[model samples]
Target: MSGQATVLVVDDEIRSLESLKRVLSEEFEVICAKDAGEARRVLESEIVHAILCDQRMQHETGVDFLKHVREVWPDPVRMIISGYSDSEDIIAGINEAGIYQYIAKPWHPDKLLDSVRGAVQLFRLQKETETAGIDMKLTPERVKRVVTEKRGAAQQLFDFDRIVHAPDSPLRDVIELGRRAADFDISVLITGESGTGKELLARAIHYGSSRSAKAFVVENCGALPDELLESELFGCKKGAFTGAYQDRIGLFEVADGGTIFLDEIGETSPAFQVKLLRVLQESEIRPLGAQRVRKVDVRVVAATNRDLEAEVRAGRFRRDLYYRLAAFPLHMPALRERPMDIPLIARRVLDEVSKAYGRAVHGIAPDALSRMQCYDWPGNVRELQNEIQRMVVLADNGQLEDRDLSPRIRSSGAPITLRNGHGNGHHNGHGNGHSVGATLKTQIEALERLMITEALDRHGGNISRVAGELGLSRVGLRNKLGRYDLRKGVSRDG
Candidate 1:
């Protein structure tokens, strides 16, 4: 063996246990357990590659115990040893439990060693597949596209640099605070509305930290069910569940030496919150179906759009976990909150989109830029990116103008004319009441809602036609519909 793979031997007979250990220790690291109970405890603390169990132990049969192992710790290859029983029962039990091999008593030491080596090789292959899938799933889309090269010491803070903003950007203070927080190894909780760049800020903190040289992994807590979320964060044994064909590595283990960004932390269930609390309290994780807990050194940076404090007060989020995650809380300001940054953000996005689309969109016309600045961006930076990409693709004369701006943006807060020249369609943003003396933000939102509502009604809720008639991408239009709660009436099938 190139490396010493740990073997766990379970036998009630002390003499037999000593002999097995003596023989196996030469080529592998051997740990002895007198019975099933002791074997489980050993497994909880150490990573064992294979197990050799005497079929006729005192309290429990080896087959019975191995069956249990298949449920909670199935990663280790199992072998049953007993010159005592060649019974049909024993053979059936071994087959059902998925034992790697059946060893007879008075076994040859050389053959036993060879079987264990093969088992170890099988274990290695299973782990490789598990970690490979985990690595692929955990790579964030932004990281795949934007963070292409590794950053040197000088470039460690470059994530923050990619956060293009104007001189008078409201996020400047938040960025400063995040940079300061990155110096320490404390947990950080970033709060904001959707598309407000919470994950972007989390990345900045990771790269700005001392662990910048290590891996930075991301997991969307809300994207998976609670059961799966747990299994993904803490590894699982082979056969731990349906579809678990191989031993798996979790994100926590993958990010052992670095940072794990848990996005949508507020959306996780209370049960999962308790599990996460344990990881933060103790720097260790017990993989599902595995007997032991493994120590991990990881910095956590969690992000959520919800008001966590309110969630805690309302009993939706665990208070203890909330405090643990918010040790250093940072807030990402929405696009509407810092409308001055729109031009700067828009231009940067335009440049990127132009290059990507192979277009000649050099800049935004003053009228188009003015309209963007005046309109309230419900989807924040992400929406701006979509708008800019659309402009770049449609920029026939090299510059985006008012014509390139979507109907919703250009006419927000402007008077709407019905067929009979009546001004009606405006409501209190939520479609309930009139907006007489509403703030600019509220008035713009009201107008946007009215436009979408009228479009949906006109097209009989046909999203494709509505998006085209309004000069908005389908995705952009869908996001608006969701933001303004207009989807309840719209029908995609229509």
Candidate 2:
């Protein structure tokens, strides 16, 4: 927790190494070495925030040694110092070591100090990010779905019909899960916050499944009154009710040989739920004033923002209907969780809005993206799409910045912690104090951990790629990761 940083300098020449120690000792805990072997021994003693090493060492190269550090350490940034004019090998080493930046021979004290300082700061931030990951109860897959979706269908939000997304996005997963439900002719309950695209997902599933060729219909259970809802879902014969002019086909009959989406299913009254249960139980819709029951092959997909389980436990929704309708369940991740996909979402939403407005805008700027990423999109992707639409029309140019975002979603405050429980900040245990710096440090460590683990996972634990993506020296990334005791399978986002 000390502001003081410890830096290790490795070089073959004793005089030059001493010179660096003298220059750096004023602001840091300087550990000097004449070779990589001695440097290794010192590294074993205590955590070194940054490493300043010469390109050429006795019998070993600095780049090669730093590569070792990248694998073993994952935080401390690596900087290579060289007197030689030829930087070809040094350049190659830069990519390999994940070296932060290079210091040419005859370096300035200010430059050297600045470089080392930046590296240390980056190290602290990255380490803080890594350490913060332990409290994230959300798994990697969930995290990816929450913050890092890649559905091609979703990328084009121009029209609901042509939603393209990569398989990785939750949109596709939801569709796939719903499609599977369609094939079995079982009921499906889709639950998520408002504007979470539950109905859209249902449509996608219905159209993609085995019942694609059949009629697919939708009815909002909450939009109509109890009597209207009942009549809408089940047909009525002529003179069945005061308003009945002739025999009417309800959604079930209309959706015969296909699927019916019951949006806001939880909004239905208990009596209505009982009526639904009967339909499920008997597979027949009893039209009012009809002599006989009519059988239907309509598949049902129900959606609601409310927790039907708790509702059933309460006196509200019926337990029988809840059990029957929830033959398959799928929960959509909120947008606050998946900030990584903001850029993609924003770009796509802008394009759709542009087409609608009959204007073409290229893209969003970095500043706008900064705000987008920082905001805790409580309403999820739906909210983001709306904001982008407002910005597209409101802003004069394509360079939408902080002001372009809706006032509520405007990024002015600190990043909101959607993560429930534990200390929102300050990993000094939990719920003690919300020390901004401490919590920020903790958050950075969590990010560091996630990035390191992801890089490692993608690279099959190869130190090179992990370091490269993390902007750490191979040695630094490995070092930080080792300090945290993360090895084997990673626990990033998870």
Q: What TM-score does candidate 1 get on C-alpha atoms? A: 0.60
Best TM-score among the predictions, by candidate number:
1
Model 2 CA lDDT for position 262: 91
Q: For candidate 1, write residues 121-222 as lDDT tens digits.
A: 556444433443433322223332323343354245457877866555679889989989999999999999999998888888888888876567789999
Task: Give the alpha-carbon lDDT of every model.
Answer: 0.76, 0.67
lDDT of 2 at 116: 86
Query: In candidate 1, which residue pairs get closer than 3 Å at backbone N, Cα or C atoms, i.e. clash?
Result: 44-291, 44-292, 72-289, 73-289
lDDT of 2 by residue, 228-295 (tens): 77777776655667886644446675566667889999899888888889988887776666554556
- The window of 10 residues in a row where model 1 has the poorest summed lDDT is 137-146
